[model samples]
Target: MSKILVLGAAGKIARHAIHQFLGQEGVILTLYLRKSGRLQKLAGDSVEVIEGDVTDTRHLQEVARGQDVVYANLAGDNIEEQAKSVVEALEAAGVGRLIWISTLGIYDEVPGAFGRWNHEMLDDGYLEPYSAAAKVIESSKLDYTIVRPAWLTDKDEVDYELTQKGEPFKGTEVSRQSVADLVVKLAQDPTRDVRASVGINKPGTDGDKPSWY
Candidate 1:
C-alpha cells in the first residue's frame, strides 16, 4: 500500500480529499496539521495525524519520511518559506511525488474581466510568494504536479475541466469537492509524472462573469 502525507490537512480542500481517499484502495493517508486540536473532527484510528508547522523542517521531514507521495495544501503570508521547508524535507526523506495546490492567478493565466479583478484581489504581494514557491518546485528533482485552480467555491458538484499547461481554462470558480477528486486521482496514478502544472475550473461557465462575481 502507498502511504501519502497531506500537509495542511485541516484545510477545507484537504478535508474533502480525506473524505474521498478513505475506503479507497491501495493507499493510507497521514494528515499533517499545525494544531492537532483543529483535527478533532477527523479523529479516528483509520487516519494518522501529525501535528507540526510546515515551516519546521524537522517536523516536515518526520512526517514525510517513508511516504510515497505528498499533497501540499498549505497557505499563508510565508507560503514560500513553507514550500521551501517541505521541498527540503521531501528531498532529505527521499519522497519523490508531490501535488501542490496553488491559485490560477499566480501565473497571470486567468483570463477575461473577472480574471482581471481576481488579479487585483490577489495583488502582486499575495501571488509573488506562490510564484516563487512554484519556481522552487519546478526546479526541483522531485516528480511534481502543480494544480492551479481558478477560484474556490463550496459547491457540491464535481463537473469540471482541466487546461493542462497550455491555454488557461476560463471559469471563475471550482468546488472544493472537484479539486479533491482531482488530487485523489493524481495520487493513484504515477503516470501523472513530473514538473507539470495545470489549471482547473468548472465547465460551461462564463469567463467574464462567474457566479461569484
Candidate 2:
C-alpha cells in the first residue's frame, strides 16, 4: 500500500486530494492538521487523523515516520519556517518525497500586465515568504515538487494545464479541484516530476487579472 501523510489536512485543496486518494485502492492516508476535529470523520480503514503543527519539527518527524509521501498544503506568514521544519522532519523520518503547494509569481514567472498585477496583489506580505519557503524545499536533498498554482477558484471542475519553472505562468485562474487533482497524481507516481517546480492554471483564462478581480 502507498502511505501518504497530508500536512495541513484541513485545507480546501488537501481535503479534495484526500477524497480523491480515498477513491483509489491500495492507498492509505494520515491526515495531519492543527485541529483534528475538522477531519475526524475521515478516520477509517484507509485513513488516520492526527492533530499536529507542521512547524513543530519533532512532532512532525514523529508523525512522518513510515510514510511514502508528504503533501504540504500550508500557508501563513511563517511558511518559510514551516518549510524548514518539514524538510528537517522528513529527512529525520527518512521520507524522500514531498509535494508542496505554493502560488504563482513566487518566481516572478508571470508575464505582461498580469505579472505586475499579481505582484501588486501578493507582494505586500505573501509572495516573499512563499518564495523563501520554495527555496528551502529546493535546497533540500529530498525529492520535491513545488506546485505553483494560478489564482484559485472553488469551481467544481478539473480542467487545468502545466507550465515548467522557466516558462511564463499561463492563464489567471484555476479551480481548487484541479490543484487537488495534480497533487493526487504526484502522490500516485512519485517519480513523475522529481525536484521540479510546476505551475498550474486553467487553459484560456489569461487576462490582466483573474475574472473576479
Note the clash tally of each candidate: 0, 0
Question: Which candidate ranks first by lDDT, i.e. highest?
Answer: 2
- TM-score of every candidate: 0.94, 0.99
Question: What lDDT tens digits, residue by residue, belong to model 2 across residues 1-213?
Answer: 899999999999998999899999999999999999999998999999999899889999999999999999999999999999999999999999999999999999999999999989999999999999999999999999999999999999999999999998999999999999999999989899999999999999999999997
Cα lDDT of model 1 overall? 0.85
Residues 1-213, candidate 1: write the lDDT tens digits.
888899999899999998888868766888899888887666665678878898899878988999989999989988888888989999999999999998787777776787778877888689889988998888888899999986788988887888877676677788999999999889999677468898888887766656766
Report model 2's TM-score to 2 decimal places: 0.99
Error of 2 at 55 (Å): 1.3
- In angstroms, how far off is 22's CA in candidate 1? 0.7
**By summed lDDT, which 10 consecutive residues of candidate 1 come out lowest?**
204-213
Best by TM-score: 2
